[model samples]
Each structure stands twice: as C-alpha cells, then as structure tokens.
Target: MVRLRWYRAAPPPDLPVRQVHGFLFAPDGRAFLRVDGARHGLPGGKRELEDADPAATLRRETWEEVTLEIGAPRYLGYQLVVDGGTHRYAQVRMVALITRIHPVAPDLDNGRTYRRLLVDPRRVGDLLGWGRRGSRQAAAARQRAVVEFALPTLDLPPDGEV
Candidate 1:
C-alpha cells in the first residue's frame, strides 16, 4: 500500500526534491485538475534539468498539462509517498491561483492530450488517486488553501477569466 502524509513545513534542503504539485484554484475557488486514463489529480510533474526551480517546473508543467498560467505559488506542504516498506518519493505541494488559461496543447511528456477540468472544491476528493491515504488529506489541503491563500486574495483576479 502507498501512503501520503501531508505537512505544512517546507522540505529539508538536503533531500533532493523529486516533483512539484499544486492545488491550483480558479477565481471562483474551484481547483484545476487533469484527467489521465481513469484517474485525476492536481497538475504537476517531475523536475527537469532546465527547470530553474520548483516554481519554474510547476509553471511549465501547468502550461504543458493544462494550458493554464498560474501566479506566484504559495507553499502549501509536502507529501511523502511511501510504498510497501520503503519510501518512494517526496512531492512538494504548492497552491496557486489561476491567472490565465488557454486551449490546452498536447502534453510534452506523454505526447497525448489531456482534458482540463475546473472541479468544485467539494467534489475534488472524488478525483484523486487511491494511492494516497484518501480524499481526506486532499480535502483538508483544500480547506487550508482557502484559509491561507484563496480567501485572503479573493478580490484579485488575474489577466484572464478564471
């Protein structure tokens, strides 16, 4: 079984960051989700050598995967994915408010295209993978996002329609 534990603290600088994920919220407070096969999850991917930083990886991944441009990302937390009796990967989860969205291009990594969905916060739980503990942690992260990022910046709309 795989377990994902969420944390509010930044990851230790020593651990090489493998991937960066985001809980991207629309202006109306919905989340930007990506559909792949039968599973859906937040938009993000592994860091590339050209990526200047975690934020850059997220921006590039978001555009490639969903065609959305996000503003400065607010650090949410990290998820430690543990498989079997060993640790698999650690992902840094950031929250960003959507600033612009366009017709999605084909995913560079997979070559196939992806469908982007603006999921209501309440329904997001149903879309995540079961590899994580469950929807409870994702739901809690959404609630924390509302309190830490979304609600405080409610009046600011980005360049495009959310």
Candidate 2:
C-alpha cells in the first residue's frame, strides 16, 4: 500500500485566504493538465467556493481550458505550503475521468487557448525537468509531487516506496 503525507503551513496576510487544485486523469491513463501561458504554469484557476463545488470547479476549469468534460472526480488529498512570506499554497488532487476531448467555441473567460496533451505517467520525470528548465517552479513541483505520490499509488512501473 502507498502512504501519502499531507503538509500544511500558515498563509500570508495579503493573498486570498484559500486555494485548491485538481488532477484529472483520462481513461487511456493519461492525466489532464493545463498549460497556463499567462502564468507560464499548468492550466488551472482560482475558485470561490460559492461559485462552484470543488468537483465542479475542476470540471469547469478543464472544460473552459481544454474543451473536455471530465467525469466525477475522486478526491485524493491536499498539501499546504507557505513561501516567501507572500504566497500560501494548497494543492489538492482529484482523479478526472475524461470521457471525451475536442475543440469548442472560444471562451473569453480563459485568458489563453489551451491544448490537452495525454501524458504517460512514467515520463513524468522528463516533464518535470522541462517545467523546471522553463522556470515554472510551481508547475515543476506539482508534477513532481504527482509522480512521487499519485502515480506510485496507481501501480505504474518504476516503483518506489511512498
């Protein structure tokens, strides 16, 4: 069995008090990710709890960005990090059951056009390296955490004790 560790840290005074994220997976074993050209990070956006349920938030973000309707998500867990005395991070994980993917009408809400790419979990190390080289620190760490904690739990090869 794989054991996951959840960490937490206090937040900075200025930033919005709460944050969350989702990890959507496709039936083909590819994981759903967003390419945020504006922030140069993975695709995702802020959520105000009142605006949508956590699962809905994940679906909405995925659809708006990638034009795909992700299936019901299975909540994995969360991580909290305090950094630079300015940002507070809460990274949440969810398994997205991707039923289909295709282009749709342009959405003004999403600042940029995002393309969905199916990624092999085993190649995550290479993805992380690319993110790091691109200076996408948050994206790199998030991908690393997924490889470290999530992928292993799924029973893919190149295993390591979690």
Candidate 3:
C-alpha cells in the first residue's frame, strides 16, 4: 500500500523528488481542478529538464494540463510517499494566488485538452478522495493563501461551486 505523510518542510535536498503539484487558486480564491474522466485532481507533474525549480515545474505543468498561466507559486509543504516501505520520494505542494485561464487547448504531453473546474475550498478534499490527510493539506494551503495572498477562502457556494 502507498502511504503519504505531509510535512510543512522545505523540499528535501537529498531525496529524489518524483513530482511537484498542489493547491492552485485563482485571484477569487477558487481552487483549480483538473478533470480526468470523472476524477478531479490538482495540477502538477514530474520535473522537467527546462524547469528552473519546483515552482517552475508547477507553473509549466499547470499550463500544460489546464492551459492556465499561474503567477509565482508559494511553497506550502511536501508529501513523503512510501510505497510498501520499499520506495520513497517527495512530492512538493504549493499554492498559486493568481492565474489566467486561457482558451482550452490540448496538453503538450498528451494532445488532449482536459476539462478544468474551479472549485470551492471546502470540497477539494472530498473531490480528491485522499481522506483526512489531503483535507489537512488543503486547509494549510488555504490558510497560507489567506495570510500571504489575502485570498478570501471559502467564499463560494455551499455546493462548492465556483
């Protein structure tokens, strides 16, 4: 089984980072979701050679997957992923306070445009189905967004609509 543990620590220098992804919020405080078939997820992917850093990785992946250009990302935390204790790596989580959603286009990697959704903060964890841990991560990111970016967290419909 795969286990994920969240830490509000900086990205590890020694561990191999498998991916970078996280809570991407717009100026209005709505969270961004990438709709794959029926499952909803946050934007992110593995590091690329051209990416300058983890933040750059998130920016490039977000744009590729959702055709959205995100502003400077705020580092939040990292997830320690253990697959049966045999393998381990880090997945960085961050938050982007501003974005410009462009006209939908196919992802550069897959050539298929994914459906994008802007969601309310309250339902992000439920949508992701990552249990309590993801909920806590979302809460932390929301808190950071509020304190650092002045994003009005949860000012959305009760149904978690944008």
Candidate 4:
C-alpha cells in the first residue's frame, strides 16, 4: 500500500522527484482527464530522460495517452509516496487546463489504447482508484485550484466542496 500527501509547491531541488501527473481539466473546467484502462490513473507517467522538466513529462504523457494539448499548468501540488514502512518517491501533480485535443490513440510508451474520462470531482476517487489517501489528497488539490484559479473565470460551483 501507498500513501500520498499533497503539498502546494514543488519539493526542494535536493529531493529526488520520481513521477509527474496532471489533473487535466476539459474546456468546460468541470471535468478532468482520466485514463480509461489500467488503474484509472491521471494522464501522466514517470519522468523521462528527454523531458526538460516535470511539466514537459506531463505534456508528453498527456499527448501520448489522450492526445490533449494542455495550457500552462498551475503547480497544484506534490505527493509524498510512502510504501510498506519506507518512503518511496515524490509525485508531482499539476492542474492543467486543456486548450485543444485530438483523437485518442495508443500510448507510445506502453502501447495501450487510452481513452479519456471528463469526470466530475466527486467521482474522481471512484474512477482514478488512487486509494483512500491519494484520492483525498487529489480531491483537496482540485478544490483548492477551483477556489483559487478557476472560480473567477468559471460559472460553475466549486467541485464537491473542499
């Protein structure tokens, strides 16, 4: 089992960053992108050597997974992953607004055909399967983003409360 705790900013540069994920919003700003198969994860994966930064990893992974072009992502948070009795890795989770998207296709890395899910925040935990702790952390970050950033420009209510 693993536990994920959310933070508002990137971890110190000295810490080892393991993976990056994005809570990608649709054009409506109500729903988010989710991979259809697998564990119902967000549209992201591990950091790659060619990636200039974590954001780049998100961009490449999103495209490879769902053919979505993301705008500048807000640094929503990072997750401290603890497994068994030891600390494992740090996962960065960004909230990106989707600008444009093309047809879905098989992921270049794993050759799995990934479909998209534009789902409500209340349903994220059920769909993403981030477990109890990770899902709670993700839901909190989503709430914060909506209140801080998306609220001004959006007409909808904040997603499922904080």
Candidate that would win on lDDT: 3
Give the per-residue lDDT of model 3 (tens digit) for 104-143.
Answer: 8888998977887777877788888889999999888888
Off by over 4 Å in 2: 1-17, 36-42, 86-89, 104-107, 129-162
Q: Give the TM-score of each candidate.
A: 0.80, 0.58, 0.91, 0.79
Clashing pairs in 4: none
User: 1 or 2: which has the higher TM-score?
Assistant: 1
Model 4 CA deviation exceeding 4 Å by range = 1-3, 83-87, 147-162
Tell me the deviation in Å of residue 115 in model 3. Answer: 1.2
Ranking by TM-score: 3, 1, 4, 2
Which number leads on TM-score?
3
Worst 10 residues of 3 by lDDT: 153-162
Clashes of each: 0, 3, 0, 0
Cα lDDT computed for each candidate against the true fold: 0.75, 0.49, 0.83, 0.71
Q: Between candidates 1 and 3, which one is better according to lDDT? A: 3
**TM-score attained by model 3:** 0.91
Residue pairs that clash (backbone atoms under 3 angstroms), model 3: none
What is candidate 4's local distance difference test score? 0.71
The residue-by-residue lDDT of candidate 2 on 1-162, one tens digit each, is 222224333333343434455555555445444544432223345675664655766677666666777666655445444566555655554445566767644545845565445555445435534343322333343454455445333544332211
Candidate 2: give the clashing pairs.
Answer: 24-96, 25-96, 34-43
Order the candidate numbers by lDDT, best to worst: 3, 1, 4, 2
